[model samples]
Target chain A: MSKNLHTSAPDTDTAIDRNVPEFPVAQDSDEQNYFKTNQPPSYLDQLHKSTKEFIQFHKDQGKGRKVVLVTSGGTTVPLENNTVRFIDNFSAGTRGATSAEYFLENGYAVIFLHREFSLLPYSRHYSHTTNCFLDYMTEINGELRIDPKYSETMHKVYKKYNDARDQNLLLLLPFTTVNQYLFSLREISKLLNLVGGRALFYLAAAVSDFFLPHSKLPEHKIQAQDHNGGKLVVNLDPVPKFLRRLVDSWAPGSLITSFKLETDKSILIKKSNQALDRYNHQLVIGNLLQTRKKEVVFVTKDPKIEPEWFRLSDEEVEKGVDIESLIIPAVIKVHEDWIKNHE
Target chain B: MSKNLHTSAPDTDTAIDRNVPEFPVAQDSDEQNYFKTNQPPSYLDQLHKSTKEFIQFHKDQGKGRKVVLVTSGGTTVPLENNTVRFIDNFSAGTRGATSAEYFLENGYAVIFLHREFSLLPYSRHYSHTTNCFLDYMTEINGELRIDPKYSETMHKVYKKYNDARDQNLLLLLPFTTVNQYLFSLREISKLLNLVGGRALFYLAAAVSDFFLPHSKLPEHKIQAQDHNGGKLVVNLDPVPKFLRRLVDSWAPGSLITSFKLETDKSILIKKSNQALDRYNHQLVIGNLLQTRKKEVVFVTKDPKIEPEWFRLSDEEVEKGVDIESLIIPAVIKVHEDWIKNHE
Candidate 1:
């Protein structure tokens, strides 16, 4: 792949083509040094700083602690002309959020990289907490008047939120769009490296495959009427497969799981197998689109046991069943069994 | 599947089993009266009402128009305890909603069955058109600061929305779950039947595969608790393939299009071909997960011509390119070209 960099500085452009090693040596005097000079820190920078501090504090407290990284939601694609639009998907980010809760319950340190506009209750911030309560009350009342069955479901959700509040184990890094997801994942991976190899990555985000390859930062707003009757087209370059690459590049021999949804049974198996084969994943949970409850087939590289399919019933489905039921036990069994066999 | 209808009725020692034809008819006055007076309408009856109303309204206009139904979003699984949780993908419902706009723009009456919490803006109601001077000022200021490229893209979205508004050709059915989606699809299908095949169905939604079977509705609010430290197991039955069934049962000859997102080149071809084989769809568009822009391979069943792949550029990605560019033109060209050749 050619290194195509876009820049506006004329002198630097010439230097860039020459591939000068001392590119950073010449600094333009007019260019305001945002980082060098003391200025009020941006919200995002502050967030990063705080997160770093928290990790250090935790590291000081202990070793051999498990840190799980959970990523959720869909990424955004920038159309040509710099305007951004989101790729469409059916994910409300529910399963990812729920799984995060399960991880926290099991006493793992969590770093959640979530998407924008997720339906999951992310933070215990006062406003969000209040909204949750209101949602709970409204659901309770609505259920009471409507079918009692619906009411029962709402009650379970209410209880889950309450429990989450008590646990207080969530850390949220919210974003929208595919680029944001990629960047956040990379940033979190770096943080994990800083903290050591205790990181476990659960890639649950649904990333968009396409995006505008070239985008110009707009200085002014353009009107809808300006581009009348003219052809406007975007050339999309393929996005890098970050999840597959992450497992390969960052965390070797660490627990990594990926999800694949298929409409066909044979295809689902094929894809799950493919995920495991390509990524060296410990487990790949596959589900079909025909049903709402998860009936997953677990695929592992370990040759001792045959692949197992676990089906959830209606009763079990409503109880907010954790993927951990399958994930935890399988992981534990794999470790224990492997130890026994190897020893 | 065994027919087991358990009806709840007061004053009966046991639930009413409708499946047993030879069971003694217990004429409990309270139960019999309740069943007689307060029974909900049948699925078919509800279907008929919605279909008749839609068809009659369209026919009364005498526009000689076609109607298309586009269902978008993920469905939920209702557990036995009557609690419902969403089993969703990362779709924001943009394609479906945008396609609805396109159909309306081209003078087709559209019934858009959208899932809950989609980011796409619905057809604007008159009430939302505020004429505040401050709003205009804010808009102008926002436009002034727009990036040129982004402004261009915004112009297109605005133009499309305006054109759709002027055309007044969209109808919406907001939905959130698979059951609701199925119910709505069936209703629209009936309406299309009434229209004498002037309807096209787009199976664009990322519908989930598994659903809760035989879950009871909750009568009261349930508290959240971790399942007791015993292994919690669930059993899931396979859900019937509704999309495949729709293609087979309802509209055999209607123009159909489907999508397949693949991670690898080989699988992309395999899945695209499989979709065509299973549903006999007119067109199947395959996209790769690594592609940044919409790089699609179009496949058809015709033996003479091979499939074509369109590689879009970054510029084109910004203008919100049409899926029909690959689907509609190919469909029209194939049918037309085939007719000429045959003649």
Candidate 2:
């Protein structure tokens, strides 16, 4: 086997920041440099305008309602410019979508940033992996109607969706690639800074930890025949640590909560604590992938208090009670206290 | 940079055929050995049972109806046993789903083997990437009803779907991984062989060309921090070439049509011809990745005849006529001819 690696700077007139040490230890500079080097998604301007419009609408009401930004699903890292292949994170966006509905129910203006085609709030109950949306609809006398068995629940979801739209309480923004997610995240956080302490950021998207930066990747699809013995070596750069900047600068007054999902239970809390210590964020929710729907441990900034556990009872599991139903209220209580402390 | 790689035999009772000279040039041996080595998906038994039931249903009718098996969408190649990241091919399953509708309209029993949650035959018109399905429905007097704008088309699609189901002319099967696809493909081909010349196989799935074989991957998710400089080298074996075996042995008498999708137009026909020469398959529909929806070229065994181009007219394109609507009819005509010639 042979190792073949070469890197070139991105072809752009935009002056990239070069004042950092090699390997970039500073979080803010890394984020700023990343944005300078890479181009944002084409639709970013339109998304920014729409989000601004939603923000203005809420402000006009003069109620000072809390605005929560919920990021959901998994972001993809493209291997080629044409993107014949990509590395995808495993997520269905169920936690974020379901939790968004609860946040809305708790009288918060919700902004949903989700992967394209992933689950959405109010639509989650009807759409599962196996059943087509059409399966729930049937035609009667040339009129399309929801299947009788599904109508009652569908009606409730429909009413909530309409109410949210009518009151202008929900905004949905979508992202697919890692670059798009990062760009959108920065723009959204900066926009929410205007709301000050009334803002909350629920960062739940399963973001790619590493990416093949533009300098390392080829412009076209990678050719299969180029490698010896069918070996493909990919060198990826660690994603710039942006949460530190989000907490310190971008949305300094907003209560930020990020999740750490691990397959192994042993390191979940330890990793969560490390993230909190490093970033100085308000909270880190640690969860094991296998038991995520049943239990979660919340780690906060206070050193005096131990990590708190939230778990659904076996009977509650059998009764189909979502763990988010329990998790959100506890977080709401913490958010209330944080607001009072900041005020 | 260092090339860190070592090969080891799979730890299983499965007798993997190691006799094939390293990277055997023949397609069939590569395919046969792939199945011999890798474990089939656990769901194969259920899929086999359903497919057998479909075959028996057709046989019991005693009408000698032609049956076509259409494979669609892209198959994932997992890099780990508990997959956190995987390589995904670029496909939406539009071609196969649209073509299946035409096959059903043309008096054929259709079996749709597709990626889970991809486009489906009658439901394609309603499901878009951005819109929630609930957007199409509105509450009228507390009853859920399709919005009037979409009602007419929804009625037509609904009627067609119900008619197909009532007639027992459609069987929808799903697969997400390459392993599941290969196993299901072999089983379906062998079962369809019982119907002889009356069976047609439409191979339209964008299958992964290379995969990280089980021998090379670990049972856990690959960590980004484990590697020096975050360099991940993945060695993927060429996907076992199965078309040769499909044409020669599994479903020999069945009329087979496969698709070749390339980004470059220069080598499109060349690659199609190469596949035909190597596999001895019936037809290869050559399409460019960018203009596939607007145009396609048909390449058959006869070199004397020029390759036929199927293009959607500007007026038809404006009126939302899919290219598959045109392509499927032409392919069906050729299948009819082949049936006569074989008889």
Best by TM-score: 2
Q: To one decimal place, how large is model 2's interface RMSD in Å?
A: 12.1
Error of 2 at B262 (Å): 1.5
| Model 2: docking quality category | acceptable
Expressed as tens digits, the lDDT of each residue in B1-343 for candidate 1 is 1112212222211111111221112234422342344322245466557556665667667465666677665554433232322223445565576556556655667776766555343322111122211111111232212234334444455455545545555554666555566656655665576554455676667664433333322221111122221111122233444445456555554556666654456657665775676656567767654562466777877868578877656666688675544544444455345334433
Tens digit of per-residue lDDT, candidate 2, span B140-160: 776778888888878888888
Worst 10 residues of 1 chain A by lDDT: A14-23
List the candidates' TM-scores in order.
0.43, 0.90
DockQ for all models? 0.01, 0.24
What is candidate 1's lDDT per residue for A42-106, written digit by digit as tens? 34565566557656655666454566777776565533222322223345576577667667666
On the 0 to 100 scale, the lDDT of residue B58 in model 2 is 91
